[model samples]
Target: MDDAIIRRHLSVGRLTILEVLHDEPGIDEDQLLAEWIRRRPPASQAHARRLPRTIAQLLWQLRNLEWVDDTEGELTITALGEYVREFARLHSPSPFASRTSTVGGHSA
Candidate 1:
């Protein structure tokens, strides 16, 4: 996969985690994992098993990107993260566009 695609997945993962935390601030890691599994039921069992590591990786990436701030067991989305999430939503692919290949530059 392209680095950009990986980056986008990291961003999306971070955004999803942040949104979950926003809904229930001060959640512990286990709670976070449970919530993620509940939200993304289609995720494979292996994926679910690896969620903690994945989330940690995403969190680290988000921290490096300045998209989140954490201290003393509390985490919060930074202004940059909020802006990115909003921008992503605004530019999200249309559901009906799947028949085309404009997205991600795949010609059909």
Candidate 2:
């Protein structure tokens, strides 16, 4: 997949979902949504109520990308999903990178 398309398919929220899925395979939607809600900052707690809808949309997007497999009410990360998760981990910007060196140690 094109890097641009891959990046476009991921946002902080979606990437977070992917990461969680990668870590916990076969997690049900409800449990996944609850976990996501629990991770949100207190100020964003208001959005927790919308987790069901948000997670549905995110899962749908990931499904379209073939990164996630929704089987019998359980979501599993596909091989592609694992690849994207690692890609994001490697490419995501770090707070200290801009001030000092890139996460990969290249001068930013």
Top model number, lDDT = 2
lDDT (10s digit) by residue, model 1, range 1-108:
333553354344565776777676667666777787776553467876787898788777777877677766676777776665555455555412332223223221
**TM-score (all chains, Cα) for each model:** 0.67, 0.78
Instruction: State the displacement of the C-alpha of residue 43, model 1, in Å, after optimal TM-score superposition.
Output: 2.7
Off by over 4 Å in 1: 1-11, 93-108
RMSD of 1: 6.3
On residues 1-108, what C-alpha lDDT tens digit does candidate 2 reach at each position?
A: 876667666666666778788778889998897777666533355665676887799889889999899999889998888887787788876422232232333221
Q: Which pairs of residues have clashing backbones in candidate 1?
A: none
Output the number of the TM-score-best candidate.
2
Steric clash count of candidate 2: 0
Question: What stretches of model 2 exceed 4 Å from their correct place?
Answer: 41-45, 94-108
Provide the overall lDDT of each model, using Cα atoms, as 2-decimal numbers.
0.60, 0.72
